[model samples]
Target chain A: METIAHKAKLSKSSPVVRKYRALIHHQQDMPVQPDISVKHLNKVYADGFRALKDINLDIEPGEIFALLGPNGAGKTTLISIICGIVNLTDGEVKAAGFDIIRDYRKARESIGLVPQELNTDSFETVWDAVSFSRGLFGKPPAPDHIEKVLKDLSLWDKRNNRIMSLSGGMKRRVMIAKALSHEPRILFLDEPTAGVDVELRRDMWEMVRKLRENGVTIILTTHYIEEAEEMADRIGVIRHGEIILVEDKSRLMSKLGKKELRLHLQSPLEKMPGQLALEPIELSEDGYELIYTFDSQQEQAGVARLLRTLGDLGIEYRDIQTRESSLEEIFVGLVNE
Target chain B: MNLYGVRAIYKFEMARMRRTLMQSVASPVISTSLYFVVFGSAIGSRMGDIDNISYGAYIIPGLVMLSLLMQSISNASFGIYMPKFSGTIYEVLSAPVSYVEVVLGYVGAAATKSVILGVIILITARLFVDYDVLHPFWMFAFLVLTAITFSLFGFIIGIWADGFEKLQIVPLMIVTPLVFLGGTFYSIDMLPEVWQTISLFNPVVYLISGFRWAFYGVSDVHVGISVGMTLMFLTACMIAVWWIFKTGYRLRS
Candidate 1:
């Protein structure tokens, strides 16, 4: 396994590395407790459609966990069950250390869900709508907290405006404001930036980072792979209602990520050299380039041996470039597998 | 007990009523006042007194009951239905609130609104006729009980309904006709013996009769039976609501 120290040496100032370091330091001081836990959870809809199979997951507090899946991969169903909006068929779910079924009030109180749909009370002022959400979680009226949440979302000026009068992005901000109103310990943002403008999307990402800094655990589902690449500390891929993979972002990249070396030769070769026939390399269609693909995590990458072999064989290369597979490519490969 | 959650839902619904004051409060008040004018003063003055009470005064309880039933169901149904329609009900469903608290907040607000409308219509009726409540305590009791019962009924309708048209189906086709035939403008005693017996089958007859008995100490049926029938309906509505929450019918999947 590649260690965090090894990854840190690769990029000293990477936010993902810094976050993992902070998580390790925090874990050493206190007993580790998952903010959300699922044990063999299963859900089947009324129409006999199995939305979720036996699944298990644990998300640490203050971590940004991203769930990546296709349209019908049951991401929303799992969230709804945890948030107590939908009924689970069997198994157990606990949030903030409370059983979601038995201690539902406490569990739900600790959670704030921003659903994928932009549902709001159109006739209500943004202030009332957000304050109402706080009250719904059984919290006392705290104008200062509401004010802070509004200002953080950049919605203070539109506080008195009816939600129907706001723009689409403003309405999206109102949804986030409402979710944050109660100061929940865990926040589930389901496609938070879907259909939002670029500016609002960036603002949402910043707010999420700030919330994480304040020790709020965030679990988000998104179709945007770049979003997961940008924000998530851990990535989970769900396909056909089953969790296929879960790993630290850096570890996943280092383990599954592949590197390709393309050597542009000075002279075209009709075919591979007889002596180099056993090498894991390929010739370009026009025989102008030599391509070698290798796992990034391998200790002996064989690049030095290949270069020495080229020199011994008098195979001249004018230029060489390497490329690593992106997370999108790895994700697609995983889903297809 | 999520009291704050209940209060939040209650206050939110009440604020919605306030926002549509002209429709929620004024419309019913004006319509009830019109009933007093047309049925109480205009046509009622030409009719003979029944049970030694003025025809106009005799119909006061029935008319109030009519408006109470309609408004209670309308207020509660619309209050809950709008949330479902706007897709905002997910918040209520996911909140740290029990089903009991949810019903208390919604039905409580609806009942409160209907009771206030009942009182306003009563005060407005004083403009055209004079009436007395022989059983003042029972009069208020019936008003509150009927409001609560019908509001619970409305809450169920709101949950059961899938579209706007379904919301009005029960109130328009079933409730309105029942009220019209249940003696809102005339006593059952004024009908033929055959029709009087048939009118007993209508549940609204018992509510109107009990309320009329509170006003004039006379009724088409015994006061105990009227109260019992209303309680029966109330209990049935309670059971239906309990079932909806327990089964998550039309609520959760």
Candidate 2:
């Protein structure tokens, strides 16, 4: 166990070593292999709540796919359907080329899920929990593989500790370890870093990047849109039980994303006379602030024209500031619209 | 369904049960001993012989069935309920552990627990009465059937129950009351014609009566009918539990 842990520690962040890792099989020979595919998927709970509606998606092998949406936007329902946890009321799902409903065992065996909830048996040791998860997938016992998973998640020293004994961050790592125990080709992380600290979050980011390099297809969901921006290769936005937009990260930022331009006057402003509002700049209720929202895709924000209009009005500004649109802002704006 | 996954679930469940050793094995032994002390001596004396057999001997099958019923109900119900309660059901549901494996693992453990408790009670009864096995096969058959039926029923209760309070509703309210009034203390033959007919509606009486017929070779109901009743109940429960799993009735949602 120690030797395996040592090897894992030595090669964790090295992408070359990760790419050649034996158990991290990405299976590059199949060019058209989709890690998971969903077709017009729909789910309605017993109580008649439609949680998912006509969802169709294809996640390619070895890519980081992020599913983003507000609460009740069918993020968990979608992942659950793909993982074969929740049965769909309508449509079909396939995981690693097997139909989820018809070939459930085969489909589920290839995928691993890190659920949103912080769920672990408090009485069980970390080793037992991860091992039990592997056994659940009908995998034969592989202690070395388990050790490597634990070390990769930085959970080697905590292996003998009870789950309740670990801190929130360590417990989160344990969840990832449990999910990866069976050496699945695809791993789904549903809000994996919800309650962890900054360092642990960075550590998880590195681990995920390493996992990706090793050819594992990763699907993650999070309210923290920034994590998606940092880790995801392609972005999908879900709203009200339907996938609204899916685009490349850079393309989405340039296409639908916007930046905020705020000119903070060094001198406090008096009341905005009704005439000053005609330039598309809104005054705060307090009458001391000016706000401008501009699209980044545009060649120019027409800042010169606005300033020329301001100068003609004889409004002297002491300072100006511009804030670019982040993934968080674009996400919130998309959902609202 | 893969049997290895079933076995894994069984091992995990049994380990959990063993962790609370007192609840599964010891508690039943202790409680059955107390029943023999109070009911066998205190109540059996006044009740006199039942159908040419001592009152102590007559209620033996009923008492054994009582523990069997309770244990089976709790074993399956608590097994599944704990997962749902602790949010570990997410791991279970997400895993390759199919509903068939889940039902078999949970119901199998429940049946195992019931059989264990039944044997313990029978061994303990040796100190109190002179009981002999007339037909060991019949006794074994009834024991297995009763265990499976109640365990399947318990599996249903586990699935239907919403929370902690919901888990107790069937065991405390329906199952226990039926076991007590199911001729455990008195044979239905001693009852008035109207009461005897009413007792027929209590399905538990059939289970206890069937078990008594296995042991003593005499019954208020025909042995063939008792066996048939056992088969009928076992079949019904199996189908119902299978359907619940197939549709993912309460579990999937």
Each model's total of backbone clashes: 0, 0
Return model 2's CA RMSD, one decimal. Answer: 7.4
Listed in order, the DockQ scores are: 0.89, 0.50
Chain A structural similarity (TM-score) per candidate? 0.88, 0.83
Docking class of 1: high
Off by over 4 Å in 1: A1-31, A265-290, A312-315
Question: Model 2: how far is A259 from its true place, Å?
Answer: 5.3
Q: List the residue pairs that clash in candidate 1.
A: none
| Per-candidate chain B TM | 0.98, 0.94
Give the per-residue lDDT digits (tens) of candidate 2, residues A293-327.
76776527467667776788777776677877888
Evaluated against the true structure, the overall lDDT of model 2 is 0.80
Q: With candidate 1 superimposed using the best TM-score fit, by how many Å does residue A287's alpha carbon deviate from the native? A: 5.4
The digit string of per-residue lDDT tens for model 2 on B15-119 reads 777778898888888888777767676777777677777787788888899999888888888888778778878777777877778777878888887887789
**lDDT (10s digit) by residue, model 1, range B149-208:** 999999999999999999999999999999999988778888999999999999999999
The TM-score measured for candidate 1 stands at 0.93
Q: Give the distance in Å from residue B187's predicted Cα in candidate 1 to where it truly belongs.
A: 1.7
